[model samples]
Target: MDLNWVPAADRPDLVAEPVRPALRDDVRVAEIDPALADTAEFCERYGMPLDTSANCVIVAAKRGGEVRYAACMVLATSRADVNGVVRRHLEARKASFAPMDQATSLTGMEYGGITPLGLPAGWPILVDAAVIERSEVVVGSGLRRSKLLLPGKALAELPGAEVLPLAQ
Candidate 1:
C-alpha cells in the first residue's frame, strides 16, 4: 500500500504510449512487479483491498454488422454487466469481451494493462457507479510492470466516459 506514487505525466515510460498524452496532472503512477499485475495477486502482494482496485475490460459490441469497442471500468470486487446493461446501453445486438489480441492491438497496451485512459477517441468508457464512489483506485498503467492511481471522479471526467451502474 505504500506505493511510490509520482505524477503520471512525469513518468511517461511507466504508462502506455496512448496513455501518455492523456495523463492528467492528478494521475499518479507506481512501478510494480509484472508478475503480480493481475488484480488478485497485485492486491494480495501489496496489502491492498480489492475494492480499492479497478479493472478495465474491453468489450466488443456489434450492431448492424458494425463492431464498436468500449472500455468498462468496475471495482475489482464486482463484475461488469456486459450482457445486459452494456449491451443495452451500447444499443448493440450483441456484446462480449474483446479478444485479447484485438484489445491489446487496438489499445496499444499490454493484455493485462489496459486502462480507460487513452482509449481511442470514439470508444466509450463505461465507469461503474461504485468505482466513482471510491476516493482513490488502482488501475493499469498500460504496462504490466506499473499501475496508475487517481481519484474515482477523474475517470468520470474523461472524454467519452459515462458514469453508470455498470457493475453486477
Candidate 2:
C-alpha cells in the first residue's frame, strides 16, 4: 500500500528534520483495522521498545489568543507533569486535557496514534530533553496500532520541537 503522506504545508508547525532517506526504511507504518484505545499495551505487543520511545500527549491551553493545543513529548521512562510543567510552560490562565475527540479532530492522527511528526502547524510541540538522550525510540505513526522506530536525534531535529526539561 502506498504510504499516506501528510504534506509539510499542512503541518506548518511540525518541524521536519533533515534526515537521511534511509529513515523511511527503519520506520514502519501499519493501519489499525479496528482502532485500539490503549497506547501502552499497543506499544508492548508491537515489540516497541518503550524505554526509548517518546510518548506524545496533547494538552489544551488558552493563552491570550484562542484556545490552543500543545503536544508534550516525553520519554516512556519519564512523564511530563501536565499540570505543573506543561501548564506553566504554556502560560495559560486555564489548561486542561483536550477531549479525545477534539484532539483527534484537530490532529489528523488517532487518539492513541498521535505523534509530534505531523501535527497541525499551530500546535506547539514541547519535547523532553531526555528523549534526545536516547539513541533510538519508537513513536506513533499517525494511526492506531502502528508505530515508527527511529533515532532519537531525528525527533529532536523536527521543527518547533523545543527541548525542555520536562520529565518528572
**Number of the predicted model whose TM-score against the real structure is largest:** 1
Q: How does each model score on lDDT?
A: 0.95, 0.67
lDDT against true structure, model 2:
0.67
Estimate TM-scores for all models. 0.97, 0.75
lDDT of 2 by residue, 95-136 (tens): 787899998888766667677876777667888888878777
Give one digit per residue, the lDDT tens place, for model 1 in 1-168: 457889998889899999998898889999998999999999999988999999999999999999999999999999999999999999999999999999999999998899999999999999999999999999999999999999998999999999999988
Model 1, residue 105: displacement in angstroms? 0.4
Worst 10-residue lDDT window, candidate 2: 13-22
Whole-model alpha-carbon lDDT for candidate 1: 0.95
